[model samples]
Target: MINDIGDLLTNLLFATKKIIPVAIKQSIKDTIYALISIPKTKIYVFRLNKIISDHKKVKGYIIYPPTLDWDYMFQRPQQLARQFAKNGYLFFFCNKSYKSRGFKEVEPNIVTCGADTRKSLSAINDVIVYISWAGHINFFRKLKYTKLIYDYLDSLKVADSKGKGLFKKHIRLVANADLVLVTSDILHKKLLLEGRIKKTILVPNACDFKHFNIKKTINKNFEDINLIVNKNKPIIGYSGAFAEWFDYSLIKYCIKKRPNYEFVLLGATIGSSFHRSILDFPNVNYLGEKRYKVLPYYISCFDVAILPFKINDITRSTSPVKIFEYMASGKPVISTNLPECKKYKIILVSRGKKDFVNNIDRGLGLSRNKNYILKTQMLAKRNTWDKRFNLISKYL
Candidate 1:
């Protein structure tokens, strides 16, 4: 009897081990999120269906899968949704969890809500499911859609954070995608080497040319930056995430070599610990972050803009959107020799310490030249998000 009991206990333990999944932490979080979202489920489902019913005659629904919150960062996903709505497509932006009450029409035809609308998506036809993150494949696979798009924006080396099992998911996504859009030439070539993709296109990052080209009066939004830009020294500024790949050492070297210039840092930081290291320099001014609406004013204040990124696989694969915004703001850009930025003749790509300093000096002179400003703005006009979207629409 004792021997039989031990054997049964052993069998149960073995079965339990096989039943449990990998990514245990993420699984727990999902369970908690679903429990908390239960009350709002009907509300969101109704809101989602209401928008769908209103636009039943439109050219297919454009589904933005749960990736980032509608307000978080306001980058590519937000831009694409607005364009989709303007083109007469109903845009549904689903969030990871319920952070707010009810659904809101973020833009004219773009409605954003939480995950309660997920199951409802699987029932709808004529939907174009657009996803960026590889981890979303599991849920998105169940959606009823006429087309599926995977935007390969960054290398996997920098993408994972939640202890994700990404490799298999990425392969499945690429294999089954109706269209694979890459943001850089490197990423595009990567797909070509994979050899079995359906169709791939290179749709690089772009800017809101009109938004950044505004002539708004510099209000209190520029108060902090104004103090530095008003000084006799020319200001070198940057705006973007201060992530792990940011070359803080390169920025320190630049600050040390150019003591006469006022260096200003804008935007938010992520996984960055070199704040104390760089801010110690007296010439360097950390201006903190600003909203996307008022970001143009901050960019306008800079005499020259900089992209001081570490040369690595993650950055090499990136098509920096800030470069286009800086160009649109009519500011001369000084950057490290990022392959993507190298294509732009207007950018002053630096090689060594002396070269970087020299480029900054060159940019200061160029900033004042009317023709240089015009040319930079013209380049931005050619690479607007509108143009990038229309190109993708052709394939869609």
Candidate 2:
């Protein structure tokens, strides 16, 4: 009963964005929220301690620190949690908002639960608590567990997205983590330079090959895309966030140069970084974000896939999952020379606007080459979430 009330105040501090001031640090908000619910916290701690006393015989348990809601755009947190559950660990992916949804069993071993969830569990002795967001530092003490792993997926240098205050949390998480998993070599190298490489491992992003490489024909349910894709012109496509880091200038150049090519975009305009003026062009089509299930159907329609991201510290650390999804679909991919993208030789790394546009034309021919298709698909098949889990499990 007490656990239920804590769930209301626990994730609500971060989840209910309109209620909380944007200027306040999430850690402070969460800390204050936890403090207010001391009675609830005591109950949760008692329940957890009682479970330890019982000595229940279970394999293990995995808990993800509260982040995005489970139903939101499926991302690394959800993907990795699924993998852990598949391996027999009872996994929980906590949400940051919509606590009213209650505890939802997403799969056989996996469930998405609301915050302050001591009622749901019977044990905490054999537990692994995984965290990606530095803001979750506030919950560290409250989440007493057997192991704590910090997945350093993104850089803290991107100042706009709570970087300044969270930087301190990053240091604390990295310093105290049982194991650290970095998604890219640049991140692994960063840890090395800082002399924090003792417990870090590189487990880069991967694709679900069987999911992306569709065997059956996709139904023509996407009525809106029919308006954009033309038989006369080739389709150059992109998916993922339309954020501040996206290279709008390069895409603008590509759109103007190839007037015949139809450019289709998927994903949401994150904050105010995306200017609507570019969408006004006749050839450019912004269809908004599709369900993750039907995302491949949209990708399969592309003659070429692109990652028009600004080469910055944030991108350098990012292992673009969309790039692999495009590869899995046997589509030729082009991108600005992000270190992660540049690692793959097949991905046409563009130096400047002219070269980026030129690559789109090259990609048209590359799409026809059966050998190119086979190699790209094979690369995607090789790097599955299952394989990524195998690497991570060894360290755990």
Candidate 3:
């Protein structure tokens, strides 16, 4: 009778264990539904959902498209934001989509705002510097800022939706800004034509020298060197996004001419019919997007770095970060004659298929020369992000 009682108790405990979780899960679901049914909670969530800003007062630099904070490339906005934060200023990165609300601290001094932040322009304290890209002109214009800086990061008129009147908005932004920063000479001239010549300053893109300057010790310590880097043939590499501006036909031509040269393209390729043809080439290799930290290892193995970009309105104003990065890696760069590339005398500028093919040979020859490598490295050292930041500091 005691053994039967023990078995009954054991079975009852086993049943209780199984029943408890199901009951708890049901209770949670019921509670969630009950909470959602409350009108005040729904209203609170709606307001919270719309806030996408850090309501911080500490000498902020407002950057539109908060996603730039996470970009591995650390473009102009992110680079400057980090420098500003390091110098005792709180950096507030505003998301482009102002639809939902919350704020996240992505870094020690950098705060990213979500869509739901309810802080008004007046409520935000110590916001002295306001810088914005072309797209966020109207959105940030209303904010009361002491110094309005318009950073023309790109030629928005050519890049954005054609019928959205974005360029028109850009005009108003230029006129309103206390200072205007253009990335290229083409942009500088454009701003001059708009009669904001005095305010416009050409602040070209720069590189993080320490990051890309891969030392000899790094090569020895790198374990994945043999796995990812192609050591068989002379590696001609290109890093950065393969967007519409990338000259695919020139890349195809280069592969056909120099079958002995192994061309490696890195970064995510935007969907294009031309991609399949380029990948089909036996001499060509595509190693998908790599983290910024490991990029130096790949670049270290390169014989020549290239910037084969199409000559168009988009390329005209682009001061490529890759050129500086390639130089910092101490590699010779063969590039098309984009306006910005021409400024760097170290770069071998190619104008056509014949020129492109010839410069690749010239670049390959230059890469082997120790003096040439040092020259390129010197150029990069001078144009470091810190140097760029110093120039920006004068205006502030």
For model 1, the superposed segments whose C-alpha errors exceed 4 Å read 1-43, 161-165, 272-274
- Tell how far residue 346 is off in model 1, in angstroms: 1.4
User: Candidates 1 and 3: which is better by TM-score?
Assistant: 1
For model 3, how does the per-residue alpha-carbon lDDT over 246-334 read when each residue is reduced to its tens digit? 88888999999999988888787655633777888887888778887688878877888999899988888889989999999999999
Q: Judged by lDDT against the true structure, how good is candidate 3?
A: 0.73
Ranking by lDDT: 1, 2, 3
> Whole-model lDDT for model 1 versus the true structure?
0.81
- Candidates in order, TM-scores: namely 0.85, 0.83, 0.79
lDDT (Cα) of model 2: 0.81
Consecutive 10-residue window with the lowest summed lDDT within model 2:
49-58
lDDT of 3 at 117: 44
In the range 1-396, model 1's lDDT, one tens digit per residue, is 234554565455556765655466446545555545554445455656777787776777878777888877778888888888888888888876665434578777888765555666665677888889888887666877788888888887777743256867888899878998889998888777887545888888899998999653557656787777668688899998888888888888889888998998887777545467788889989877788888898888888999998898888889999999999999999989899999999999988767888899999999889999999999999999999999988987
Please give, for residues 314-388, the per-residue lDDT of candidate 2 as tens digits.
Answer: 998889988889999999999998999988898999999888988999999999999998999998988889999
Model 3 residue runs over 4 Å out of place are 1-69, 96-101, 118-122, 128-132, 161-164, 216-230, 271-274
Please tell me which model should have the higher lDDT, number 1 or number 2.
1
How far residue 215's Cα lies from its native spot in candidate 3, in Å, is: 2.7
